[model samples]
Target: MSTATNANELKITRVYDAPVRAVWEAWTDPAQVAQWWGPRGFTITTHSKDLRPGGHWSYTMHGPDGTDYENKTLYYEVEECARLVYDHGGNDDRPPLFRVTVLFSESDGKTTMDMTMTLPSPEAAAETAKFIKKAGGNGTWDRLAEYIDKTQSGRESFFITRSFRAPIDVLFAMWTEPGHFSQWLAPAGFTMEFHDADIRPGGSTFYSMTNGQLTMYGRAEYQEIEKPSRIVYTQQFCDEQGNVSRHPLAPVWPETMRTEVLFTSEGPNETRVTVRWEPCGEVKPEEIEVFKQARGGMTQGWTGSFDKLEAKIAGSQE
Candidate 1:
């Protein structure tokens, strides 16, 4: 006689805007994974992503409220261009990590994916359904569906679609060195001049700015650097010397903010740049609320700066 172990399950389905190839890359590539891996107001910071059987993927999910959710997962199976399976709760110390399988198939030049998660227990399944926000089984499926919308086989990464007016090669070069970066890397009416721009994996940059008497200093530490394609760095408000420091106005602000910037080339002359940021230090509820409120202003400032960049690019070429 043999004893049997039973486990619970949660299933979800989502259609993507991308092709099968792009969808697959998004799920596998570290840079692509960071772009849309989170929900309405969350971003991913991958510490380690080794996609292979018995390997593990670990990362922290940053919430709009400035909270950090650390996670881990174990890869069970991978069939290139076909499927991905992993034990998620096995991914972390969480109680209900289970086997999750995803199937990717093509329909009318589009890719459709189906996901099935077998939980360790009924309680875990209940957790997946109830926690619709935090990468519960259902939430993960929803994100997958959103991913397909912008990906395609043989196409570029998603970060490149954020819009760029400069020639692809020019923008690519600017990111590789510190001297060129000092030109127009700000959010309009503000420019960054690096005191030191050591842009390499494990290197750092310290820069000063003049944004209309609202001069702010920033420091960035590169985590990974793939020249002409991606640059992942942790950014923070800094002192005049470009050392990471507490925000002058708010002591409660996270001590360090991690941000990843990726640049993609559309054509010889077009480029796409995506920037993602998260808190690296402790976050309190009140500070989180205030930071959320201030995000809009920051967006406006960046848009203006990019707008100027477009003109600068045009004038130089003409």
Candidate 2:
């Protein structure tokens, strides 16, 4: 992801496994868009769509709690699968909140989507960003990834992203260095301790986390480590002696999960972290279903961990 140079703009970028044409179709087709457009738990009803310059799209987003949000988008530019420029978040009662520019590019059979949302002012942009986070708007892109994955390969995965105001190297170290990692990797109310620490390609670690009442052990085997950019590992629950085991509380959980973490420099002193998680080796259908059903819980847990990570970064700077 690239940082927005304009203070009034918010930028986001994501790469999908699908090709450019497939991704373009997913975004342009009303039926496909409806499958993964809004935040999780929310659905939309498209009253009309006119995909051309000077045309408009009208839709109503239905909230999980029965509330409905009407939206109107006016298109200014449309370049087949290359780019789109439009005004978003407007309705009959008010003007548009921001202008959106989206660019699509492909390399090595993967499609990269870059989006910029420009608000009226920097304050408005900041406020909107906060509101989006609180409303789980980021999940919309994650859902898109899931949709593409299911369409292309009959597989399921989980995705999450967060941006922190810290240097890329510092953020990367927090993930690779055992001390810094243990300080913030555990969920809220739990403390982590690394019994065996080795973080590198082909290396592994055994750790335990406890919330005073109960303790759980886990192991991670690192498969790849690209300095300050990417890390791939496989994680599994285990006993105190490091013997592989099923989740203590959720037996239906997959035994092993492959996690890929990508770190991108958004600015001189900021980094955006994106995580992709999927079942590793053989996985049963029941386990996959359980994983799909527990996405909400997974989001909450990861959010709590990120909060702690932010605090730790702040403390380090101070």
Candidate 3:
């Protein structure tokens, strides 16, 4: 059997809101580098950044529990404002595998970035380097996604649907009221603390969450709010700047996303809610893969949210 053909290959693409120059700064600047680099529970500490060809970018990551991990990479090709190629890996020799390419283009004063990563051949002893990229790539992509949601973005529209047991009024209240929203907006184990929720067209929902050690901001804009029946909005991840962002979990997830929640009363006290999602396909392959998740995922998320809202409202009524 041939060795090359048997190799495991992975391909992912994420478009950034910033130009290649800005991305290069985020990828190189020590302070900006540490701000959003590494995984959710990890933080980065940079030792040096040399962006030109043959130069190196070195840093260490501090995990939630105080574990330190070193990372070092050398840039191979640096075509400013156009492309960058590099070889990166952990401190030790895990074959130091994989090559990354980033390209940037400008149209109508907005920048587009495309990143492609290729791993070492199947023959490499430590062929799992790409899998070890959770430290920075995912989170880094997330920050770029933040920049995209408020600007030009991409991908097709997808839907996430589930039913709610409460009446249309009750379900709608959870979304329109800031206090009501704080109780059920985030995933389990995370608590949302709202700053304010403006519930009309052109209004916004601003909030934050403390997921153990990770403090993150979330935002949504209300477009067409048709009381207790329908609501349209755009949602995104962000930092202190309130710029649109991405999911902290997956990088390829869309940035600027269109969300629609429709409520149809099935009975006196039951409401059927249908949620649809459409990624603003500004990026290439990333937006194309936005709706590829298992159908069961939306069910679980909406179900959990419904359960939480039911309890919150039930307690209020009592």
Best by TM-score: 2
For each candidate, give its TM-score against the true structure. 0.49, 0.95, 0.47
TM-score of model 3 relative to the true fold? 0.47
Residue by residue across 99-148, what tens digits does model 3's lDDT show?
77677776655565555556656445234533444232334454444433
Residues 188-228, candidate 2: write the lDDT tens digits: 99999999999999999999999999899999999999998
Candidate 1 error regions (>4 Å): 1-161
lDDT of each: 0.65, 0.92, 0.64
Q: Distance (Å) between predicted and true CA of 50, model 3?
A: 68
Kindly report which residue stretches of model 2 are placed more than 4 angstroms away from their true locations once superposed.
none
Q: Of the pair 1 and 2, which is ahead by TM-score? A: 2
State residue 48's C-alpha deviation in candidate 1, in Å. Answer: 44
Question: Candidates sorted by lDDT, descending order?
Answer: 2, 1, 3
Model 1 C-alpha lDDT versus the unseen true structure:
0.65
Highest lDDT scorer: 2
Q: In angstroms, how far off is 280's CA in candidate 3?
A: 2.1
Error of 3 at 315 (Å): 3.0
Cα error of candidate 2 at position 318, Å:
2.3
